[model samples]
Target: MDAHPDPSAPAKPSPDPLAVIRSRGYLRILLLAGLIGVPVSIAAYGFLALVDWLQEYLFTELPGVLGFADVPLWWPFPLLALSGLLVGLCIQRLPGTSGHPPSEGFKAGGFPQPRELPGVVLAALATLALGAVLGPEAPLIALGGGLGALAIRLIKKDSPPSAVAVVASAGSFAAVSTLLGSPLLGAFLLMEASGLAGAMLGVGLLPGLLASGIGSLVFVGLDSWTGLGTFSLALPDLPSFSTPTAAMFLWALGIGFACPLLAWGIRALARIVRPYVHAHRLLVTPVLGLAIAGLAVLFAQVTGENTGEVLFSGQSALPSLINDGASWPLGAVGLLILCKALAYGLSLSAFRGGPVFPAMFVGAALGIAASHLPGMALVPAVGVGIGAMCVSMLRLPLTSVLLATVLLSSDAYAVMPLVIVAVVVAHVITGRLPEPPGRRLSGALPSASPSTV
Candidate 1:
């Protein structure tokens, strides 16, 4: 009979060469990742452009219009005070508390909601454009994550929560791809921050890589079109580094031990100031701004150098500092370090931005000064100091090593061993150090409803 089928017999499924891909839904998610990356990258470009324009107008053009060809030392005080008030208003009124505290470093926080994006953008614009001593990384990360979530919800209304998280991660990767100057570095930073491991790591990383690759392309294109130059970290002309001598290794150990203590002191000071900042945010934030401005003024008066050296996130200034290391007197470097560190600490307590760049600047300064001492060369000392300080502050050994070495370009290969040693030593010591008492870890806020996204 033609229709004789056994009820108990299992039906055979059709074979397909791409069944693995279809079963895992890899193609769909990857396609979605590519789609997610384009908008996120554009958003990142736009945000950076806005900040650049604002910074120039507020800090440069505004001052020139006020009859000063260059920003006077006293300019930052009033400007930052006003910025503090504006940022304070945002934090007081806006959602997501303007993202997160700078004191927490980088955390594995989930994506912020679309509603929270404005607050973040406003606060960061106020802080950075007005000369706060913090980096753009934290706000960029928040914006990227928020945009990612918002895009997915709009495109696929019924996307699973898991899928949303993956896309969000990819968006963050794409957002930071150009900023870090390497998509690989951005991927590593996100991967390490996410704490993913084993087979799960590969699965999670694939989408991020795809997004980052696309984002990097967008960054290059936009950078070309705008001719603004990619605001990426680069040390295009680093002095040659020699093989590590015993004295240089000794210097590395010393810096490794000392950098964590410096980081701890900064953290401890932030803990001391946190309660005051929270209790009187409007008052304290402005005061903190004034304090940073005051340091910049003091540095200028004492050293006869540009006060701008002591202000802002220290990203653009890093290359200059390294290139002109020989020009600075040892004592001036020390004073700059003290002033910048104090400003960095105050900013951490009251401002809203990332901590990575300032810490790197401080470490690099220390290294440059230490190199002035007999027995150490400048380049190797810089690499070691950056690795140690970054590891101590960020607690990300691999990323720190990459940051220190990668910026050195081919010299990175030669100095890699020293960077590794410093990173390991700093990482271990930082781990052993006791956590600051009475400080609450910055945790991720609850995700907003789909409507909010």
Candidate 2:
């Protein structure tokens, strides 16, 4: 009886310790990807630096030389609209290159084919120079990712899916590293965007993070060696902090509540313009471009400020918006926010660029508006506004905080608490925002699919 095995107690099978990963082919692909990523990251970093120079010296300076009352409000509008058209055409016409960063959202891995890089570069530079509501950082990631994937394909006859993802991540890390002003932000962006889980997190994340670290180093080295300067959304003269006050915390709380409203406004405008952009694709796009130009003219005329206030890049204007204006009336501040927010929403929908800078501009404007209220300091208010807006737009809490801190030179410590409070408030407020009507799932309507990449 004892020798007879019970029917329910048969011999147990041994577990293969390596069974989890050994069966999957992704590990080999990941290794190959890391091997190819190092140089690609370096190249991407170098390219961004060059583009940075062009944005400042070429785009900013060109109009001054042309001299149409400082190139007039209409100048960049047409050039940028044409750029959006080209980018749209490129996305529609090019196989494996059908989308850019803005359309793609925050998905982790991306690599555009080499053929698409030229279009990506031209569109991004043109869009930026033309004063589109978009940001350059988004395009930079696409360019980097696409070029990196292209490199992998060339070097290897066939690459594993894992390797492709790793390279793309590395390329992205490099491309936007300088814009973040810290490789850590780049890494955080990737990590938060990836949606990776469990063991898969370690598979290629390390290599991708390594690439970003090296890329930032390369960016710093080149900036030092060439004295070309590292490109950042920062003003060198941003005054240092005194100690943060309780009022600054209140500013964060207020910014937190206000951020959702701004976010909704931006998205709503984008939705409104998207159909128009799509319907008129080739013909109507240019008209929309002219409209933006008209709006710019109106913005300058109504506000009685330089057309530059409402025009291209807006990077230079960020610090000014944050810096308190004793002469700026409350009415002017409100008008600035409304105009910039509207322009930002329209520009985001029809134009090609990133959302980061526009968000900063919005926040800065909001800060200016709030500063007019009693008991608010300019720097802390600006920091709260920027951080809150970023949280709403990107939904990246850590990234928003870093962005806030990096901008303040002396008062970073004081600003830190406010940034945290603002980010948390912004994040919570963002959740309260209702998803767009078209975004809801229903059998009767079009599918709103969720994507991992």
For all predicted structures, in order, the TM-scores are: 0.92, 0.81
Best-fitting candidate, measured by TM-score? 1
Q: Candidate 1, residues 1-453: lDDT per residue as tens digits? A: 759989789998644535534555667787888888988888888888887788778877888887987777698899889878888888788876786777766664367777888988889889888888888888887888788888889988999887888888888888888787688877887777768776456666788899999999998898889997777778778888757788877878888898999888888877778777788888988888888899999998999987778888888889899889658998899999889888888888877888888888988998898888678888888888888988888888998998888888878888888888888999999999999754563433223332221
lDDT of 1 at 94: 88
Q: What's the lDDT of the predicted structure labeled candidate 2? A: 0.66
* lDDT, each prediction: 0.82, 0.66
lDDT (10s digit) by residue, model 2, range 347-433: 766566677778888887787677666777777877888889888887878878888777676777888898899899889989888
Worst lDDT run of 10 residues, candidate 2, spans 444-453
Model 1: which ten-residue window has the lowest total lDDT?
Answer: 444-453
Candidate 2 wrongly placed segments (more than 4 Å): 1-70, 96-98, 101-106, 197-203, 324-327, 437-453
* Candidate number of the best lDDT: 1
